[model samples]
Each structure stands twice: as C-alpha cells, then as structure tokens.
Target: MKSRHIKAQITSFCFILPALTVLALLLLYPVVTSVFYSFTSKHLIKADYEFVFFKNYIAVLTDPDFWTSFLTNIKWTITSLFFQIVVGFLAALAVDRIRKGKSFFRTILIIPWAFPSIVIALSWKWILNGVSGFLPNILVKMGIVDTVPQFLSSANLAFPVLVMINVWFGAPLIMVNVLSALQTVPRDQYEAAQVDGASPLQSFLHITLPHIRIVMGLLIVLRTIWIFNSFDMIYLITGGGPAGLTQTVPIYAYNVGWGLKMLGRSSAVTVLLLIFLLMVCMLYFRILNKWEKEA
Candidate 1:
C-alpha cells in the first residue's frame, strides 16, 4: 500500500514537471541573470564581463536622469491609476444599475481592453500625430485651435496625453473586474438596507464598498506594478521625447542598456525597480490583510 502511494505521488510530480520547468526558464532565468549581471561590468556588445561589486548600482543611483525618470514614473503611475479606478468604478456602477442590454454594453465598453498593447500604442500614436492626425485635424477644422496640437511632442501636453491614453486603455479592465465584484455582493443586503430607512448612499457606503474593498485593493496592487513597469506604450507613442518629460525608469533603463551599451547599469536599474515595487506590494498586502480581518 505504501509503495502504491509513493508511486502515485511520483506520477503526479512527473505530470507537473514540464510546466514547472517551463515556468522556471521563462520567469526565473531572466531574473537570476539580471541579478547576476547587475554586480558585474556587463556590456551590451562585449562578450567579456567581470565583477564590479556595487559600481553599477552607485552609478545608476547618482545619475540625474535616473532620478528624473523615477519621478515621472511615479506621477504617471499615480495619475493613471487614480483615473482608471474612478472611471472604471463609476462605469461598473452604471452598468450594474441598468436592466436591459447589459451584455451588449459590457462588450462595447471592454473593446479597448481586448486589443494588444502594441495595437493600442500604435493606434493612439496615429490618432494624436501632430501634422495629419484625426484629432488634431478635427480640432483645427472646428476652430478649437489655430495650430495642430502637438500632443506627443509638446512637453506640457505629452505627459498628460499619455496619462489620458493609459486611463482609456486601463479603465475597461478595472470596470470588468469591479463589475464582477459588484455582482458577487448579496442582493439581500441591499434589500434589507432599503427596509431599514437607509438611503442608497448609506447602503453603498456601509455594505457595497466593504464587500468590494478587497477586490479593489488587489486590482490597485496589480495595476500599480503594471503601470510603474510599463514600457511599450510610452516607448511606441512618445519614445520619451520632448526634453524627456515623459521618460520613465523603463525607458531610462532601455537607453542605458541598448543605447549606451551599459547592460550592468541597466540591470541595476531594474533591480532597484524590483525592490521598490516589492516594498510597495508588501505595504499593500498588509493593508489588505487588515481589511480582510475587519471583513
């Protein structure tokens, strides 16, 4: 009997071994290599590398450009995340209140979320092109402005425009998730609240918000990491141009590794990014635990 049980366990392990191997190759390999490379004098073109201890880290930490990109990354993540949550939550509430065509409306609204990031970035880039883009031409034709607005090139407008585009792309995901969470809420609770002379706002605050709070917290944590580490949208649309106003840490790291051939320094930047994000996630999970206990 014991031999049979051991065989069963071994078979189960064998069944999952392939998936485990792939996961390690995909996820763990890059992380381990990056960490190893960060402590060495690795170059993009050079095949030879040597241990440099903390030199790469010190160089990255002292660079003014790195700090500037870090600041922009923070602002970008916070603003984009704030709007995404607000827009998504409000949209989910509106969809929930409606009785007819719920499926159609949800489908239409989530269309943006269905597209690949590359598609979204390229489509927005064309739409916001300075010379001949649809939005600029339409605005000019309507006398909204005398000149075509350089949405991607203008320093003042570039960051905000990117934020707007991010919100549009990200909000739909939040909306779908929030909507699902909203549905999980017990209808009987709302009905009970109504019988006790509670207003809609009162019931929503006391009941609706609590039940969905955990889901929203988890969504925020995921979105925060995603937006902070975002690369493609900014890279494709603006290329972190117009006096580097829209440059984020990922872009900075890309320029360092690919442009300057400083792979070691770039790896250091990524390591720092990982550490910061992990800390942020830890704080978030702590809050989530507190909320769960209260719930």
Candidate 2:
C-alpha cells in the first residue's frame, strides 16, 4: 500500500514538473534577476558595473519626479475607478430592468472593452489632435475656441482626458460583471421589499447593494491594480508628454530603463512598484476579510 501511494505521488509530480519548470523559468527567473539588478549600477551597454546596495532606492525615493509619477498613478487609478464603477452600476441596473433590446444594448456598451486598447487610444488621439483633427475642428467651427485646443498636449487637461478615456474603456468590464452579479440576486428579495412598500431607492440600497457588495469589492480591487499598472493608454495618447504631467510609474520606469539606458535604476523602480502593489493587495484583502466577518 505504501509503495502504491509513493508511485501515485511520483506520477502526479511527473505530470506537473514540466509546467513548474516553465513557470520558474518565465516568471521566477526574471523576478529574481530584476531584484539582483536593482541592487547594482548596471547600464544597458556598459560592461562594468558596481553594487550600489540601497543607493538606487534612496535616489528613487528622493526624486520629485518619482513622487509626481506615483501621485499621477494614484489619481488616474482612483478617478477612473470611481467613474467606471458608478457608470457601470447604473448601466447594469438599467439593463437589468429593461426587457426589450437587451442584447443590443449590451453589445453596444461592451464595444469599447472589446476593441483593442491601442486602436482606441490612437482613435481618441486623432480626434483630440489640435492640428486638423475631427473633434477639434468641429469645436472650432462651433466657436468653442479660436483655435483647436490641444487636449492631449495641455498639462492641465491631459490627465483628466486620460482618465475619461480609461473610464470609457474600463466601464464595460464592470458593467458585465455587475450585470452577472445582478442576475444571480434572488428576485424574491426585491419582491418582498416591494410588498413592504419599499421605494425603488430603498429596495436597491437594502436588497441590491448588500447582494452585490462582495462582487463590487472584488471588482474594485482588481480594477484598481489594473489601472494603477496601466501604461499603454497613456503612452499611446500622450506619451507621458507635456513635461511629464501624465507619466505614471510604469512610464517612468520605461523612460529610465530604455530611453535613458539606466537599467539598474529602472529595475529598482520596478521593484518599488511591485512592493507598492503588494501592499495595496494586502490592504484590500484585509478590508475584504473584515467585511466578510461583519457580514
């Protein structure tokens, strides 16, 4: 019996070993290498390098640009997330109550998410371009401005525009998730609330909100991480431009590593980002655990 059990364990290990090896090579190796590089003064082309220990971390922490980038990331994540959730929840509620053309509305609403991010970014870029662009030309024609305003180029306008674009792209995901969660909610609860003369808003607050609370929490955590780490939308639309006003941490890391050829410092930035994300995840889980306990 012991020999048979040992053979079964060995068979399972054999089945899983190849996947484990691939995971180690692809994920673990790069993470370990990045950590090692973060402690050194490595450059892209330079052959000679020296161990700098905490120097890179110290420089990054003291740099005003890093803090600016981090703040920008926070603003982007939070603002976009708020709009996405609100819009998505409302859309889900509307869709849930409607009976006709449901599929059509769902299809149209989800197009933004289904479209490629790069394509959407480029399309918005063209529309917002100050030089002979479609939307700006129309705005000028309507006497909204004397000249076509550079929406993506202006420091004051760029971040908010990016957030709006992100909201458009991200809201569809939340809509679909919330819609699914809404479907799973027991219909009898709402019916009972209605029998008790509960108003629509009251019913939603007491019945709907509690039912979808878990889903909303999980979605917020997931979207927060995704938005915080987002790079392509900002990169394609503004290239972190107009004097780096829109540069998030990923963009900063890319600029340092590839643009400036300071690989070690870039690795350090990456490590810091990882640490920040880990902390955020931990906080989210702690909050989630607390909520579950209270429930």
Candidate 3:
C-alpha cells in the first residue's frame, strides 16, 4: 500500500513537472536575468558589457525624471484604485438588489472589462480626440466650451482623464469579483439582521463589510500592482506626452531601455519597482492576515 501511494505521488509530480518548467522559463528566467543585468553596463544594442557594480541603480535613483514618474505612478494607482473599488462595490450592490434580469445586467456591466486594453485605449482616444471626435463635437454643439477639449493633450486634464478611463476599465472586474463574494455571504445573516430590526445601513456596516473585506483587500493589492506596472493604456493613448505629465515608472523604464538604449539602467529601474511593489504587497498581506485571524 505504501509503495502504491509513493507511485501515485510520483505520477502526480510527473504530470506537473512540465508546467513547472514552463513557469520557470517564462517568469523566473527573465526576472533573474533582469537582476543580473541591473548590476552591469548592459546596453540595448551594444555587444560590449562590463560590471558597473550599482552605478545603474545610483543613476536611476538620482534622476529627477525617475522621481517624477514614481510620484505619478503612486497617484495613478491610488486614484484609479479608489474609484474602481467604490464604483464597483456600489454597482455590485445595485445589481444584487435587482429581482429580475440579474444575469443580463451583470453581463452588460462587465462589458467594459471584456475588451483588450489596446481596444479600450484606442476607442477612448478616438472618442476624446480634439478634432473630429464624437465627445468633443457633441460638447461643442452643446456649448459646454468654446473650443474642443484636448482630453489627452492638456497637462492638467490628461492625468485625471486617464484615471477616469482606468476606473471605467477596471471597475467592472472589481464588480464581478465582489459580486461573487457577495453571493457567498449567507442570506440568513441579513434576514436575521432584518428580524432584529437592523437598518439597512447598520446591517451593511456590521455584516456585509466584514464578509467581503478580505476579497476587497485582495483586489486592492492585485489592482495596485497591476495599475502601477500598467503600460499599454497610457502608452497607446497619450504615449506619456504633454510635457511627460502622465509618465509613470514603466514608461520611464521603457524610455531608458528603448529610447536611450540603457538596458542596465532600465533593469535597475525595474528592480526598484519590484522592491517597492513587494514591500507594498507584504504590507497588504499583513493586514489581510490580521483580518483573517479576526474572522
């Protein structure tokens, strides 16, 4: 019997070994290579390279552009995450209350999240374009402004507009996840609260919040990392233009590696991002663990 059990275990490991190998190649290999290159004088196109021993890290840390992009990344992550959670949670609540056509409404609500990032970015770009755009032309016809709104160009409006677009794109995902978590909360608890004469707000504060808190916490952590590392939407829409007002760390790294051909410095920038995000995730997981204990 013991020999049979050992054979079963070996068979299971054999089944998963190929997946593990692929994972290591796809994820670990690039990460290890990036870390190794970060300490060297690697260039994007040049063949000659040598160890620089932290010079790349120092250069990236001292550059003012890097700091600016870091700050912009923080703001972008926080604002986009805040709105995504609120709007998503509210929408989930609204949809959950619907007695009829719940599936239809849920499907319609998640349509924004169904498209690829490229599609979303290009669609929004055309809609908000300064000339010959639907939204700008409609606003002008309505006499909202004398001139067409440069939603993606004006420095003041660019960051906020991107945040709004991100929220629109991301909230639906939050809604779907939160809605699933909401379904798992037993209906008896709410019914008991109602029988005890609890107000809707009171029941929500006492019961609903606790039940979905962990899911929301996990969502926040994942979304924070994703939004911070996000490149496609902003790159496709604005290309981090208008005086670099919308530039984030990923774009900064791209500019360093591709535009300036400083692969070593770009690797250093990515390493720093990895360190920061790991720290953030650690903090989030600590809080999540505490919540789990409380539960």
TM-score of each: 0.97, 0.94, 0.97
Please list the C-alpha lDDT of all candidates, in the order they appear. Answer: 0.95, 0.92, 0.94
Model 3 residue runs over 4 Å out of place are 1-6
Candidate 1 C-alpha error for residue 146, in Å: 2.5
Question: For candidate 3, lDDT tens digit of each residue in 207-260?
Answer: 999999999999889999999999999888888887999999999999999999
Question: Compared with the true structure, what per-residue lDDT tens digits does model 2 show for residues 1-295?
Answer: 9999999999999999999999999999999999999999999999899999999999899999999999989988899999999998889989998999999999999999977878988899888878978988998899988988889888788889888899899999999999999987899998998999999999899888888888889999999999999988888888898899999999999999999999999999999999999999999999888888877
Q: Report the C-alpha lDDT of model 1 over 185-285, residue by residue, as the tens digit.
A: 99999999999999999999999999999999999999999999999899988889878999999999999999999999899999999999999999999
Q: Give the clashing residue pairs of candidate 2, or none.
A: none
**What's the distance in Å from true for residue 96, model 3?**
0.4
How well does model 2 score by local distance difference test?
Answer: 0.92
Candidate 3: how large is its RMSD?
1.3
20 Cα displacement, candidate 1 (Å): 2.0
User: For model 2, how big is the CA root-mean-square deviation?
Assistant: 1.6
Note the residue pairs that clash in candidate 3: none
